[model samples]
Target: MSWYNTSARQLPWRDPGTDPWAILVCEVMSQQTPIARVLPAWEEWMARWPDPTALAEASPAHVIIAWGTLGYPRRALRLQECAGVVVEKWDGTLPRSREDLLSLPGIGPYTADAIIAFAYRERTTVLDVNVRRVLARIYGEAAPPTSLKAWEVERASHLVPDDGEAASQWNAAIMELGALICTARNPRCEQCPIAPHCAWLKLGKPEAATPRKVQAFEGTHRQARGKVMRVLRTAHAPIGVEELRERSGLPEVRFEPALTTLLADGLAAATPGGIQLPIE
Candidate 1:
């Protein structure tokens, strides 16, 4: 907590008065996307839709277009769905309990726990990949990163401070530590706050027994999907199939599967003339 007070990044989402909805947006946008990009989009999103009710009332195409180049366009659709639930079911007030938050579209264990801890001021564990790595390196003899046995929630639940304030700070601190110093590649051990007691350091930092594999992003369905979403984001009207193909830089390839996926995910819509983002 002391380290966090002195070193935490000055982010809009960390503002003392940031509301639950904004926090939820930040968490969702930050998933598999850099905070640098998430920041601008979040600001615009909040400016346009200050609450769940506003977001729920917006057109899906507007939301997707506003989501911009954040890659996973489906997250925008899910976020909109989540907003609708919050507005319709919870009256625009985000749930205070983990179970209810988890019941919302796109809300999962980690997100639910974060809402509980950060927004609700309850003692709860937040276990992102960074937190996972930090914990695995710290109390590792008992639970190494390699040991594929148990669950993160169960393990992380035990480490949080009993008090709400300290617990939230601890969650943020550990995650920041991992992201800034204890990085996946070339950790800055000297700058680490807990370096003196880090088990990985003591053990000379052995390589992973089975290294994690990196998935290809380029030349994959994800790339094609992103391409399609990008086209829709910039279009003023529904784009024809041929136009979509030409704009997508894949004129020879048929994107029927991608279009179907976009429709199913509620990220796009079909029109008589062409395909477009969902109508309001």
Candidate 2:
């Protein structure tokens, strides 16, 4: 906790007394997107939505536009859907229990547990990438595996502090440690707060056999979809289906899936004249 107090980034989501809904948004936005990109988007997103009731009343198109190049736009749709439930069923107060949170759309075990620990300050484990890396280095004595094993989860669960306040502090502390000093690439082991206890460091710090690859963006269907979204977001009127195809410039093979995704995810609506963002 001391190390995290000194070393942790002053991220907005981690600010004192942040709302549970905001924490949920942070967890979802940061799932696949990098934190650097998520920060500004989060600020804009909070300013726009502010609460679940506000987001539930928002148009799907507006939600997608607010997402803006975070990638995996479907998550934006899911977040809106989740907000609807929070407002309609829970009366805009996100449920405090883990089971209730997990039942919400886009709330998986990790996200549910995170909300419990970070937002509610409940005794719960947050097994995010950062926490996993720290645990792997300390106990497993190796680089964190790409896929979490059952044993790893079991071992980690036991480490969660039984007390609510202590658990929250410990959870945040480990995550901050892994994200900074115990980083995946170029870990600063010398300055690590728990380096003396890190088994991987004692074993000479071997690297993972395979390095993670960055996904290609150019000419991919995802890029085509993004282009399509940008056009729809900025358009004053609906665009013809034919015009959308030309504007997206995607091959028939790529175009079909991207268009289907936009429609299926409710990012676009087909009117008699053309296609545009969903109407409020």
Candidate 3:
């Protein structure tokens, strides 16, 4: 906690006065995306839609365009859906309980726990990739499993402080520790606050028995989809199929499948004019 107080990055959402809606936005934007990239986008997004009411009223096209290069554009649509639900069902106030948060679109267990711990300052186990890795090293003497296990959740739950305030701070501290000092690729153990107690470090930092699988991005359908979405986001109006395909720089085979998936995902829509971002 002391380390976090002195060393943690000064993020806007960490402000004590930040509302749960803004914290929810931060949590959504941070998933699978680096904070550096999320920072500017988040600032602009908040400036445009400061609350659930504002976001709920925004067009899907506007929301997706505002999402920019966050990679998973689907999350932008889901966030807007979540905002609509918040406005209509919850009367524009974010729900406090984990179960209630889970009911919101785009919110999973991790995001729910994050909102509970970070937004409401509740005593809940908040685990992200970084926190999971740090805990695996310190307690399990190895990297986290390819998938999270029941035992990991149980252990993490058992470790949270009983008091809500302390637990929230602990969650933030551990997550920051993992991001800064206990990173997955090259941990700076010498400077880690918990290095002395880390089982992996004490055991000489043994390598995983099997190498973790890395997901390829280049030359994949995802890359093709990104190209198509970029074209849609930049277009002044609905673009013809031929123009979209040519502008995306993807071959017909790749472009067709990417467009199909984007349409199915509601990230894009087909209209009389042509293909464009979803208006609804």
Candidate 4:
């Protein structure tokens, strides 16, 4: 089937008229977050900020709070920073070029390409985990994409329709195919639109030798850091070291490491009383 013949889910940002700022917001929010969770947040954000200028003018603390419950609150700061750059540098516009978007704070290759293709309706290869999985399955590759290979982009670029409107639809359709059917876990292959052409399906889906790496969460320094940040994110004033120690439930030694990590990562800042979100 042609890429367009495969029906896909309709996403707000996939619409041709979606503003670049809104598309950028979706990209950041969707990082490490499921689409189900990001939709409501995106709606609220668009309703509140509407554009780069509005987000740039808002306090970082307000942005963090508004970002509500999206883990990795530091992204909020980087997003605010990105908005400021977009408004100040781009004259209140998001740059359409991939290189220019990549130059923005917190925007990496995937995000840059995503904004260009989805928001600006540019014909560019947009690769994310889902797209990678779909590509791998279609090619019957054993390994998932380790790095952004030149061929991968070229292949995706070829699939994009030459016409602007169809190209946008193809972009969204491919992504929706990846998310709903060609999933990493518990994929619903029977319902996939492109199952007939799937090389993995033809060859019998083979398991990869190495399982995907999973990050250790519990009992790690990240957990301790999260505990510390959770306390500070909720606190109205800067907290002291002693209070952080008590709240994070980490040893005195671990507390130092956690605070240091947070500070180094721009997730937290040192204060006279204790520590706080960089807002202070």
Most accurate candidate by TM-score: 3
For 6-120, candidate 3 gives per-residue lDDT tens digits of 9999999999979999999999999999999999999999999999999999999999999999989999989999999999999999999988999999999999999999999
Which run of 10 residues does model 3 get worst, by summed lDDT? 139-148
Model 1, 1-280: lDDT tens digits are 6767787778988888789999999999999888889999999999999999999988888888898898787888899999999999998999998889999999998899888877877898888888888778776432345433356667877889999988988898888887788888898988888888888889988777777778988778778888888888888888888888788885455476677677888788888978888896
When superposed on Cα atoms, how far off is each prediction in RMSD? 2.1, 1.8, 0.8, 2.2
lDDT winner, 1 or 4: 1
Candidate 4 Cα errors over 4 Å, as ranges: 1-7
Instruction: Go through the candidates in order and give each one's C-alpha lDDT.
Output: 0.84, 0.87, 0.93, 0.81
Error of 3 at 194 (Å): 0.7
TM-score of each: 0.94, 0.93, 0.98, 0.91
Span of 10 residues, lowest total lDDT, candidate 4: 1-10
Error of 4 at 249 (Å): 2.1
Candidate 4 clashes: the total is 2
Candidate order by decreasing TM-score: 3, 1, 2, 4
Q: Write the per-residue lDDT of candidate 4 for residues 231-269, one digit (tens) a residue.
A: 777889888888878987888887888888888877777
Which pairs of residues have clashing backbones in candidate 4? 239-274, 240-274
